[model samples]
Each structure stands twice: as structure tokens, then as C-alpha cells.
Target: MSDTTQMETGRFALNSLKMLLVVGILTLVANSIGPETGFRAGFVESIPGMGLIVLIGLVALLLGRAIPLDLPAFAYAMIIAFALALPFSPVQGPFLGYVERVDFLATTTPILAYAGLSIGLQTGRMKEVSWKLVVVAVFVFFGTYFGSALIAQAVLSAQGLI
Candidate 1:
């Protein structure tokens, strides 16, 4: 195989390993607490989402490394997005709303950051440094947040799960 192909493969492997480590650690923690929490329904329901987020985050990490983009820029964008989504994420009642919100943030943040990082790193100059880009990024972040919510709602509606 060519050098580029080999490098890509190596990077993918490394990223996958990192993701596995993270997931393993998280799972251990969850398992440790599950018995203590009574292990009834709540813990069972939330683990899959947590796993999904970890999987997505791993993919995003690999993609980010493969691309020539700024990691910090991507992180900044995600942080901004998380801030916007926080207030709207339902965190109340008996359900583990806080855990769900955290999972949602985990799933979305990496993707958003990857996007922003790709743009910021590839472009000759960051319009990102300017106030306009910040405003635009914020809007885009909110757009994604709300758009995901709508899509999720539609899916739930179709499934009669809403």
C-alpha cells in the first residue's frame, strides 16, 4: 500500500483504540453504579445513547485527525453550540434528563467541532477570527441544535413514540 494509505490506516486504528478505551472506562463506571441505582429501567435505557455518542465521537476524532484542520477551532465551535443547547435541553423530573442532555452534547459536539475545524483549518484565513464568523457559527450551532430536535420529534411521531 501507498504511504498515505498506510498512514490513514494507522490513524484510524489509533483513533478506534482511543474510543474503545473511553467507552470501556465509561462502561466500567456505569456498571459500578448500576447495582447501586437499583438497575431497574433508567440505567438500561440510557446506556445505548451513551454508546452511540461514543461511537460517533470516535468517528469524528478520526475524521478530524485525517483532515488538515484546527482542533481548537472545532472545540470552540462545539462549546458554543453546547452553551446554546443547554438552556433548551429538558432537565427535570424523575427521569435522568441531565444524563440525556450530556449524551446529546457528546453526540453532537464532535460533529460540530469537526465541521468548524475543517472549515477553519482548510480556509486560507479564518473569517472565524472576525465577529461575523462567530455570530454565524453561533447561528449555525443553534440551527443544528433545533434542527436535530425537529428531526428527532418527527421520527418519534412517525414511530408513535413521541
Candidate 2:
């Protein structure tokens, strides 16, 4: 590949990595507080914006080190604004029920989509492959979350922790 192509590829990888880091950290914070409390903490306390902070921080660090701003700042700003505003709208209130919780998840989707797209693109086989890997990833993600919740509930039941 040409130098420019290599640079573009590197930029894509770096952005994807940064997005993944933000999502992972957001997930950790949400999970640590437990579901009920996390839902409260997210909307009332700005838990979703935590991911934005991490993204901007990473960008600033990259700029300080002389890395070009490959990611579009305005696009992210619009996303953040939309994320912060959508749940508060009356239309979404009836459908989602919990404005804060729904907003938090809504905000988190961009990064998750970015990560998933990065994976699907970088594999170089998505264009030729059947739906196998996509199906597998979906199942794996669901399985891990469901399995953990089930195990936790079982342990709590056995120990009377519930």
C-alpha cells in the first residue's frame, strides 16, 4: 500500500481503538453501579457524557502529540447534542419510558457501532463471507450478558443474597 493509504488505515484503527476504549469504560461504569442504580446515575448524573469526555480527552492527547485530528469533531458534537436532547423530547418519553436510561443507551450506540463496523471492515472477509461471523458476534455478546446475569441471580438465590 502507498504511504497515504497506510496512514489512512492507521487513522481508522486508532479512531476505532479510541471509540472502543470509551465504550468499555462507559460499560464498566454502568455495570459497576448495578442496573437499577446505574439507570438512575446515567440520566440524572450524566453518565453518558462520561464517554464523550474520554473521547475528547483522547483527541486532545493525540493533538498534543502532533497527530492529525482524523475524526470529525463537529459530527461528534452533533451526536453528543442529539444524545443529550433526544430522551428529553416528549415523543421519546412514551416509547422508552425511562428517559435517562434510554438516553444513556442511545448515546452509547455510536461507539459500539463504530467498534463493530471497525471489526467487520478490518477482517477483510466480510465482503465475501456469509452471515456466520455477524451472527456469532451477536450471539456471543448476548450470551455473555445473559449468562452473567443468570449466574449472578442463581448465586444470589442459593445464598439468599436476593
lDDT (10s digit) by residue, model 2, range 70-107: 65554554454455458676544432343344345544
Pick by lDDT: which candidate is best?
Answer: 2
Candidate 2 residues lying further than 4 Å off, grouped into runs, are 1-120, 133-138
TM-score of predicted model 1? 0.33
Residue 115, candidate 2: alpha-carbon lDDT: 80
Clashing pairs in 1: none
The residue-by-residue lDDT of candidate 1 on 28-144, one tens digit each, is 444434434433224456665455445545655555566565564346435443543565555322223323423333334445655797887667665438888779989999999
Q: Whole-model Cα lDDT per candidate?
A: 0.55, 0.57
RMSD (CA, Å), each prediction = 13.0, 13.7
Model 1 misplaced stretches (Cα beyond 4 Å): 1-7, 10-18, 21-43, 72-162
Per-structure clash totals for the candidates: 0, 0
